[model samples]
Target: MEQNTAAVIRLESVHKTYHLGEVQVHALRGVTLQIRSGEFVAIMGASGSGKSTLMNILGCLDRPTKGHYWLDDADISHMSKNELARIRNRKLGFVFQQFNLLSRTSALENVELPTIYAGIPPAERHKRAREALERVGLGDRAEHHPSQLSGGQQQRVAIARALVNHPQIVLADEPTGNLDSRTSVEIMDILQRLNEEEGLTVVIVTHEPDIARYAMRAIEFRDGKIRRDQEIEERQIAREVLPTLPSLEDADAEEAEEESKVAPGESPAKAPA
Candidate 1:
């Protein structure tokens, strides 16, 4: 990807604290970071590490206790809820752990949600929804309800809904948490293909290590601060898993052999962490 250096999300000395009856709960402790446009990023942290808090603030669902946050052109830290709602509906797409589709609604209708909020007319909304669903390879299931779809299909619908708004950045929290191993691969393949083809900026949060490998860079968090950010790269693809592993230069042959022998069941990749 070209290095444009334009930041889509920027945080400066941000802190978020909650007071539970005078006992201060520091969720985020002065975090300063920037996520550039068209970059695939994964944020990983354990419970109470502030990943969720940061995700909420980044999504404009909550205000920071302190700090300056800029999402695109707006200073999001102090925006009114209504304004944040508008921005979220128009500019940000979200995919959550649970497929949050309305059980009775058709895939097309679910995808049409943000358009409805945007006040787009029914005709245009349907067209856009159809196109979005088709992009996720679910065009034929446009009329199916959530209950009628498989786990992967339902998640695809959720992804379709996220894309229906045509937002450049997608915030996904444990998007594949509920899927099994094979199914998780299918979802990552979709996300990876989307990143390569459309250059969509996707930020995902996950605890799984393998899922993190799918991302270009993974940002690890601890105690509300970024601990380490590493680039997990894709290995060179051979047509098939080599029967007899070739020697790796500049790497321990024993360790390389161990890594090479890893089963496909091992990694579904995390946000890259």
Candidate 2:
């Protein structure tokens, strides 16, 4: 692989071991990889393949048992828990499979949570949170609670929360796991725009082959090691793909028409989250 001067993440022969009641499990074994700045990459693997362990380490949520892990050329493999927490707040953003937004809180409030933890002033926090929500095309929905928004909209709020901190890399784990196909594409479009227009580095962990097609590169893991690393020759553009998908407005109209057919006092069924 060619060396990049702007390598954002580098892991050298990294390993992670877990000891569960005298049963030892090696989650990652001698995995060496480099992810450059502003690149979108997908990490694909089946269960027990160590991709989740790798993601935990990359997100600074866990440490490698052996070997070096560097973030922006700074060795972090052995950093103290407090130090790692600080670095995570300063340099990384995370989007989980669950939207993870506070259900009762407004979207803007959820996005502002990170900045509050980072010690930003109240005025600055509100400003940044609103800007982040606007960036994700959810400015009008900022006052709405998670329960009021659709699945894709809630995920967009989560993405906005991640961006409010102005981090270097966005680490997303199965971000589209909860949504329908069309909604998943909408989420990917947001991520793609962030990577292309704003030069944000994105690394997503997914099992869906079609979802991985949107990334610039793919890394496959098996038996706790990297089995394949390929630069994608033809990446799908999520923006272009969205236009070809079914419109949410049409779906809403169809649902309302169905609801009208129901007997009085019968509530409409909610869509799957």
Candidate 3:
């Protein structure tokens, strides 16, 4: 897919402050940044570095205390809650660290949720949800609930849900945090494919340097401001790295071997050294 150079998100002198009792907490300083359409960006920071705040602002979940925010060429700096809700449903998709799927609902049902809010008709919503699940390689698991799936599978379902709306931008916050190393790569591979093949703008917030390397650009936040903003040199391709990592079967076999080493009455951790 051809990359678009138009700016999808623009923030100028953005600042966010929270008042707790008499204390004012400045979550974001005068931050100015622009993310182009069809770009993959990673925001990195520590606990109080303000990356999360910026994400909230970008997602239109909260209003900026001061400054201008333009998303998809519209100034949404001070949109009403109802207006923001409409914008979120129409233009943005979000994935979180936790899979956030309803435990009792089927994967297909979960994916259909966003479309419902978008006022899609029932038949079309079902069709789109099925397509989304297929895109995430979970077409056969449409009837399965979250409890029936593995952590990685659950996250895949979440990704499918995010895509059901055909959102222009996907905002993922620590998307791989709950998965194992190999599973993390698998998730990243999906994200990479979405950006490269589908031309969807991807922005993620992560603290891991390894994870940041998968993005084309990395923005580091410190003390409520952008500390570094630069292109990644020699960026990693997740699909290429997957082949070098051990498979799930290999991991299970290694675990079984370790268990066999333990005496009948002893646990694996208490086995003789």
Would you estimate the TM-scores of all the predictions?
0.84, 0.91, 0.90
Model 3: ten consecutive residues of lowest lDDT: 264-273
What are the Cα lDDT values of the candidates? 0.79, 0.87, 0.88
Per-model C-alpha RMSD: 9.2, 4.5, 5.9
Ranking by lDDT: 3, 2, 1
Q: 119-231 in candidate 1: lDDT tens per residue?
A: 99999999999999999899999998776666667778889898888887889888888765445566776777677689888898989877777788889999999998877
Candidate 3, which segments miss by more than 4 Å at Cα? 1-5, 249-273
lDDT for residue 78 in candidate 3, whole number 0-100: 74
lDDT score, candidate 3, position 162: 91
In terms of lDDT, the poorest run of 10 residues in model 1 is: 264-273
Candidate 3 Cα deviation (angstroms), residue 77: 1.0
Tell how far residue 54 is off in model 2, in angstroms: 0.5
**Colliding pairs, model 1:** 210-269, 210-270, 211-269, 211-270, 212-269, 212-270, 212-271, 212-272, 212-273
- The reply for model 1, stretches above 4 Å from the true place, is 1-5, 235-273
Query: Which structure is stronger by TM-score: 2 or 3?
Result: 2
